[model samples]
Target: MPIGVVKTERSIVGVACLIHKDWTLRDEKIMVVNLNIGSELLCLVIANGPNENERAEIQDEFYEALQRELDKVKGKFILLGDLNGR
Candidate 1:
């Protein structure tokens, strides 16, 4: 699985995310994200594996989605995540 998230705040920024990769023969991808408006925090997660092709695709898709989400926020922002795009 692959995921990415971003957060924004008035004076501070907080971003969080995760990524998991497998070492098996088969390939799989998983992605997740969480946005906490009250806490002013964004969480992202990325889990991918088995090969480089799948990793690259996950990374590409993640960035695309991440950027789109970031555009909706304002003020100081933080972007963080573990994108297993290896």
Candidate 2:
């Protein structure tokens, strides 16, 4: 699965994750965006997790990876996307 973010003109003051390789999982299932909004910092995460049909191990790995990203965020954040879980 792929992920992305769309922002209005001049809405984002700066992008902290410029390198895709550093912010996204190897399978491209998760995308982390650290945005500079005015005087505040926001961590925006878009994730596509393994569906119910997928192997349990794969699902576990996805959640673990997601947790790792969340742990790295220090301030205000928003996580929105298809987790693929029931």
Candidate 3:
């Protein structure tokens, strides 16, 4: 469940988390990256939530963690990934 961001040569980007542990959970289900594209700062998050078949607690924890991460962002952001929700 590794997550990443790809850019072309002309793109300007900065990664907030250079190490995997700094950006993702133990399960590697979620990842966050703070990027500086030119003068604009963006908080980019990629997540993979547990499926419907997963346990309730797992689902709860995933949503809670996701919310906590989003709450920490101070500026503009884009959340894109498979939430595994209905």
**Candidates' TM-scores?**
0.34, 0.67, 0.66
- Candidate 2, which segments miss by more than 4 Å at Cα? 1-27
Candidate 3, superposed: residue stretches over 4 Å from native: 1-27
Task: State the displacement of the C-alpha of residue 38, model 1, in Å, after optimal TM-score superposition.
Answer: 12
Which pairs clash in the backbone of model 1?
1-29, 1-30, 1-47, 2-30, 2-31, 2-46, 2-47, 3-45, 3-46, 17-44
* Model 1 C-alpha lDDT per residue in residues 1-86, reported as the tens digit of each score: 22122233221212223324321211123333445658575444333322345566755764566566556545445443334333
> On residues 6-27, what C-alpha lDDT tens digit does candidate 3 reach at each position?
4342222222335434344323
lDDT of each: 0.40, 0.67, 0.66
Residue range 1-86, candidate 2, lDDT tens digits: 22233344332222233444435433456777767779998878877677788898988998998898888889998987778744
How do these models rank on lDDT, best leading?
A: 2, 3, 1
Question: Which one wins on TM-score?
Answer: 2
* Worst 10 contiguous positions by lDDT, candidate 3: 8-17
lDDT of 2: 0.67
Give the clashing residue pairs of candidate 3, or none. Answer: none
